[model samples]
Target chain A: MPSSSSSSAPTPAAPSKMYADDVSVVVVLLDANPFFWSSAASPLPFSSFLSHVLPFLNSVLLMNQMNQLVVIATGRNYCDYIYDSSAPTNRKTGNGKMTALSCDLVAKLEEFVVKDEKLGKGESNGAVMSSLLSGSLSMALCFIQRIFRSGTFHPHPRILCLHGSPDGPEQYVAIMNAIFSAQRSMVPIDSCYIGALNSAFLQQASYITGGVYLKPQLMDGLLQYLTTVFATDLHSRAFLQLPKSVGVDFRASCFCHKKTIDMGYICSVCISIFCKHHKKCLTCGSVFGQAQSDAASETNKRKTIRT
Target chain B: MPEVRIVARNFMDMVASLPAMKLDQLYQNAFICQAIVRSLPPLAKKYVIQMLYVEEVVPGKLIEEWVLPDGSTKYRVAIDRLVQLRIFSETFDRTSGTSYRLNPTFRVNLQKHITIGGVLPREPMSATITVRLPSLEDLEVYAHEQWECFLLQLINSAQSERMTNISPAMMRIFQRGLLTQREKDAPRLTESGFQFLLMDTNAQLWYIIREYILNSEELDIDSADLIAFLLELSFHATGEAYNMNTLDEIQRITIKDLADLGLVKLQQGRKDSWFIPTKLATNLSVSLTDSSARKEGFIVVETNFRMYAYSTSKLHCEILRLFSRIEYQLPNLIVGAITKESLYSAFENGITAEQIVSFLQQNAHPRVAERIPSVPENVTDQIRLWEADLNRVEMTPAHFYDEFPSRDVFEAACDFARECGGLLWEDSKKMRLAVKTEVHMQMREHLRGQR
Candidate 1:
């Protein structure tokens, strides 16, 4: 139903007009969170991870000559566009474009990781930091928007988040904003959580955007999971059996405490969540008294029941 | 649209039609394997990639479980296509049930292509030797001009302004399907040729390419090698000049033929010669179903049925003349209208209304292409109605049986013909019945048996 609504909305540049000829544009958000991958408990090494990912990238390009790929490395505090297939290459390498692309991607990713590590060392001694997923998502959305605006033919654009980092509770609002933007644009946000635990934020993002979200049981078979589940273009996904979402965690993080809560007090004017009652809304600065709060809570209770 | 679909299938179908040994041999080349994978159905491509590294045979049930219940139709189609192309080798076992494993050659080659990467046979020539080479835009223009010239030669050799130096061998390829010649008359466009003219450029290119490959044996060329080279050529960067000396004997000849089709542009320097692949050459490996890969549309059709084409090429004018009356032409634009008489003429030439309408829609100007119906509904409807007017009367070849010995015999014959689903007409009073020509022999035998 979301697909139908998004397609029928008459958006200026809707990617919903997918023909067999239309090429897929996948924006890959690679989690370069050094803290997560370098941890002793991590199942796959960073080097082996690249070995798996490079083939997956090649396979995506091999699926269609015109299929476009954009790789973004999401580090602790920043995300950078590392490799773009559409970027014109001036160097005439003896090898094919596929080889050139893989080489460039690995080089760029190494450079990004080195810079991020240096920055992280300066900022915090050895503290764990969440991958800048929200920033990467926003960047991916912006890049897709630019492609849509400069349209010759509308390409099917989707964001592929390959990360193991757990969700950052503080960045809840920004991540949700990116999710809704992706939903509105009908760009599925497929998430392949390579981490040890399930990412609730990504689960909700994939659920909302009608994308496949999978956490492979065996980390060694990451390439298989990516090729079988994530490599499928939007049009072909209609016929494939993708991993189904059992249930989404709809819990909201309170605006004040930045702690995720199942049952929360809603701000009357701004709809901001709070762990406890407040006289004024923190988000919109709208004043609310006891009666107004009671009414808002009553409506929120009904909405919760309906959902 | 059906013609377009046929064109899409022609190249892959040719690949599928190859003998198994040759196909396996062809798969030895990593680029050809990659090309085959690229041309697979979307679901099939996923299956190949999923099983690329897995050495064990997968149960058919496991692959089936990958699709939803509603997607079983697609699942079957995907599996069938894979099997047809020999990408998946199926085996039946008593205990394991049916299982499939990737073809070893295809898997190994594709894996190498993905992991180690494929190297082109020839590297692009240095800029110093190929000084003052054409820019990408110039190469595109040259390719377009060459293709237009070739098509014009197809339409009418004498009418083409430039002497199309297409070799007799190339002309022979077109002759087999598109053109027909009388004893002493100039070769003329056949029914399919007229329809071919209306097809999108990519489809037309595929048709010609398929014909060329089909006729490769006559030229003592192995089609598998030809296909491998063609697919490899597509992997090369467009407008980059590759040294001709690096090619083998068969490839050198094939490149010459491809140059004639404007797939690649040939360039000569003071010391050496090389071939620069144009967009057409680069598009060769692109799956035929990728209609968007074709050039941008240029024809704009209004509700009034007036047409405007913004192409300077004479080929566009000739193709438009097939289905519309060209009122006038400017340096860069042509004005035309779809009239009843022109439609009739087109229909007579075996061009269908749907073909004309689809041609308009496919080549619609970018300004109107975004609309829901690229071609106006009224115009399409009128075109269909005009075609229907020509097809109002039904014609059938039948054998009339009369003067039967008795009413019962005639009634029995009528029932027999009706049962066969070939009864064209029957009249119990006259004791006469007409059966389709195909059923006449059966009817005669049935009557004798009755006797």
Candidate 2:
């Protein structure tokens, strides 16, 4: 028996071969972290990250004719829209308004970070995760709706990047909600923690959204990472090696204390989450007021039986 | 057959979810469409972006002023194409309307794209170094193999070859509707089968996968899963292995077929612990401009109709033999001639002249490809003439009309037929006409009452 393997190295029959010719939509979530950017001006600064990211963005533009890119800046206040090459008005501005807008948005994000860090002391990193998630997501949904509504068919092969940390629980919840929404929309989320000190939310965002999550060790070589791994558009990535994330932190933050934990108690009435020690749920106002007393009595009965 | 139609309709329903535009209208009206499509200039994309957010019609004159005088025509053409494509919406503003604003969708995306200086960087991906998962390679391989197997099934079933190397489950799927099984286990190929074989790899793959997707619904596979898997497969690189455990159940079953077609290699048994994706699998979603695909071009054609293929693989020889009359084969070169007999033989074998010509044109030798006309015009003309010769019996099955109410009625029917491209023959003297399609029959009936 030839055993199938030895039957003359299978020839790549032209007519019988499969070819890649798809358009992938890449949504890059620009971190609105003016705090980390302001704190560091050197090796791992915002400028450094941009220098790394822009080329990868260009590579995606070069990947396929149908490929589209969406940029959303997550910052304080409203999340600003940065870019989407597929949109009609963005393609024809004679005055370079889109570029101006992007520069302005990034600048604004930086300015907010600087202002927030100078005014407040600690734990107030001006990272507005909600705005970023909401803004980028709204744009993506709009684009998708346009695709679905237009009589001519448009295939959406997608890659989404959440680039920084969530500011707090609200931002975390919003980002999580966005991840689920993206999942429902069939958009895969790929996330990067460029200068995130504690971005457990983004890590979960990536995990839930079927996106690749990366935390770079050598922060300076950000571009190399983007190009080699993320730069591979949905089509090109098929033929090129890609890096995969390992050991994701699946922990969630409790709604009561807003602490990241592996296990937590849930309120039966309103589905409010709590990390041990609360008789009544703060979010839902559900009462298990006598739970501690009941537990003590049960333990006392067990002691009596043993005696 | 009805079952197949149902499958096809469901598949189309999924495709219906995407954005749509009439290509003809898009090219004629939108300038931005032309610019982005032909890669005119960075300024064109910029112009489109600026106009997207604004709700006013920027006058054509203002557009002229916005762009440099020398590049005015380019910008105009770009705008024209975009408007034609409906990607850009044009409206005449009644109040101080000097220019056109960009459409909302285009404006939003373009603003976002150009802002970060044209798309956000894909760098510093989350899974960088220190601890990268090893199973991605397996997933990549599994994806490739699954796709290739589908292609091979198309070929083997068409040829009716006794190749059991492919899995039985895949065979059943092919038999089901993905591929129309041969009447017998004979070595002959049918018309549809041969036509499938003559198409370019890209088109062929699309056809097979489309068929596979249509058939997947019957297999209890979610259409979304198929679409996602197909899209995801496009992201894996050739020669790399991916974790098999990462694949969904339907995909796990599909990978076996891919390995059989040389699209990928399976490391172990039914579970397939690790698999390596081949070039075919990795390039499944890539467009022609992709450098890796361009680099793989091995066939070189000559204007004199002499052909030389650089591949030593038997597969190349087999494909070449489909049209070319092979003279001899060497370690690295296979010499062939494009004779009239060979062309007719190919036509008889269900190959079209266009396919043969395109195949040669696509794989033209690097030397010839650099020329202004990749393949000599004479050779192209010859191929077409040969195919034309075979189609000498010009005939169309049509409905005839002899009795007409008046010349006007007959003329009206004739005009409608001409517009529909269905008029085969006509005689104004007898008030008679012949239309080559049934669609015109109803059209003629509608014209009768009006006349």
Candidate 3:
């Protein structure tokens, strides 16, 4: 089977590559920065991201017969599943009620939000990456688990994400767990961080998970990037030469300061990274005594505290 | 490293055992298969849907009337593919020409797939399916390393085994029919092997999985179970871990083969736990033609007959070596030339100029891809001309029919042969016409005792 991407010309069509019908579940994560999206001249507006990426999502929907699209908004306590308001097929469910088109999807997404809020919103300034990651991943896992039970498990359902923020340092471990979940599951994560100045966490998400991570330089050309970068299903990405970031920032976030750091002291017990010179591991509560050689020179140097 | 002929032979051998045949064949005698039920193009699939509830297969001639005369070609192609693949069949009658019939199992499954809106009816029903569960960890690992190992195995096979980057278990899978081994010596590519290398990432994975499924039956596993699992895996989302509790006994057993092929990640001693279907597993059924439009970087061919690929993956480089003579490789750049010698070498290995040209155009980088003709017209023409130099003669083995009682009979048979592109050579003299196709020979039998 020819696995070339373009079929317009006389190129060998890769017949066995992944098609839209091969998709089982499609998870779409939208960046809900309404303040930024609503601003008159926001650097990266939500509407722009939507207009740029939705067509690609629609293209994906158009490709598969059994394909499903689940859109989730990630900002504050604002997790909502958006409907594909245009789908004629969706209109038939629940006796022609469009809302019924998203019944199961909305219920699952709500389960995520309710469960996270119950866990008492953590200290991440209302940016719900943890909830997004946990809820989305677990729900996906649960859904897959159920399908497998019914003798209908799809091993590689695709996840198309549109986000514009770094994952919190506190949720780094959980996020990595989610990343490993994806990696181990053989799912390639395709992500587009539109108009974000700097996002180390998402870079790692795209890179670690073997998904396409594109930062659209030309904001207006968002659709092109989405269709080109995220549109190719997991199967075809192998043969067609894809553009990947050469220099990925592989740095980790410091647990102590909750800040991204170039270098940091890792706790010997838990491997929790920290930026401060500490006598004990804050995460695991392990204490360390100063060595004699270090103590002997301690009196020789004095440190000044900045106000 | 195997001889190109041997590699090609092995690939053909493997293709013979491809599990895809069962799906095709199940529909062969039958009208449709369930997994592919929802996948039929809306129009043709709609045709099938309309015919599903009916007791009779509409007469083949009626199909022409249903579709506009201008649209007959497409309708014919679809119906022919369905028949060729055995999804639909024509039943004969003494007085009438023929009527189409849907394959029984296919008709049932397709109706279910469509009527249920593609969400399979939850009822257990008569179709038998069993469940086995996998843990979260097992699912994750299965998905991660399968394709990586498969690609690594292909790359490493081209070089020395020791220098190869793939793992041992992965290598062992290659040694078995699960992954076809390129002999460690000859190092030239055969037609099928060349085609395999040139396939998109997803198709390549299926090429390997189909190979594995071909071998699975030999290990006493039910091919249907494997197929069902594969179809299920294709629907699973990426980055999600599935519980192992849902696996069937056969499916659980199949996980070992999948893991060996790097299609699934199986944690140690976690037979009952969940396993993830890697991108390779999930994309096993994706067609290869859509890769470029959805891909970021693409192949760019210059007018001077030079080629540049903007990729760093070793697998891509290995694929390039199938045709192009590589000059140098930078961090993310590969430079190659389309020389006459390389083209001749490719042809010598049984690859056609058409395959080579199409491969180049298919993988054309987006920069060069933007142009109407990805490759310069001169370069494309040269490649074809170079191929013509090698393949100077067109040869085929066929049965020749010449004797005919009358000009009317000879002319009728000749028209049929010409329509099928089977008429090789003919002489109007001596009441004889040379017909090349044996398929028409069968038709000749039908015309017997008529005139």
Every model's DockQ = 0.45, 0.04, 0.02
**What digit string (tens of lDDT, one per residue) describes model 2 on residues A1-307?**
0010111221111111223234456767676555445554223666667755664565456435456777766554445556766654432222233343345435555665565445455545444333345555566656666665763234544545645544465444455566566556656667767544535656655565556667766876665566445644443233333455565554555675666665556555664555664667686676664635766734432221000
Residue A81 of model 1, lDDT score: 94
- TM-score for chain A, candidates 1 onward in order: 0.87, 0.69, 0.69
Q: What is candidate 2's TM-score for chain A?
A: 0.69
Please list, in the order the candidates appear, how each scores on TM-score for chain B only: 0.86, 0.52, 0.60
Residues B1-451 of candidate 1 have per-residue lDDT tens digits of: 4364335455888899999999999988888888888888778888998999999999998999998888888789889999999999999999989999999999998888777688877778765563777889999888988888888876675557875567876787676667676779776666778777766667788888888887887878888888888888888988888888889888888888788879998888777788999998888877455554445789988889899999998888888887899999999999999999999988987788888888888888888988979999999999999999998999999999999998888888888999999999888887888889999999999999889
Model 2 docking category: incorrect
Candidate 1's displacement at residue B20, Å, is: 1.7
The lDDT values for all models are 0.81, 0.55, 0.55
| Model 2 residue B176 distance off true place after TM-score fit, in angstroms | 10
The C-alpha stretches of model 2 lying farther than 4 A from their native spots are A1-307, B1-153, B157-203, B236-241, B261-264, B268-272, B276-282, B288-292, B295-307, B367-381, B396-451
lDDT of 1 at B246: 89
Our tally of clashes for model 3 stands at 74
Candidate 3 global lDDT: 0.55
Candidate 1's iRMSD: 3.1
Candidate 1 structure quality by residue, lDDT tens digits, A68-149: 9999999997889998887877243325545666778877888998888777765745454578999999999999999878
Q: Write the per-residue lDDT of candidate 2 for residues B1-451, one digit (tens) a residue.
A: 0011223222223343433442322233222222232232233344443353456566767766644466666667667655643456677666645455565554444434433333211121123223333365555555444544454544453433335365566556554432345767544444455555544454445555666666777877865556545544544544445667767677877776556655556665344366556656655544222212233457666778888888765555766776779999999989998888888887886667777777777676776666767777888899999999988997778888788877877887888888887888899998888887666667757685675
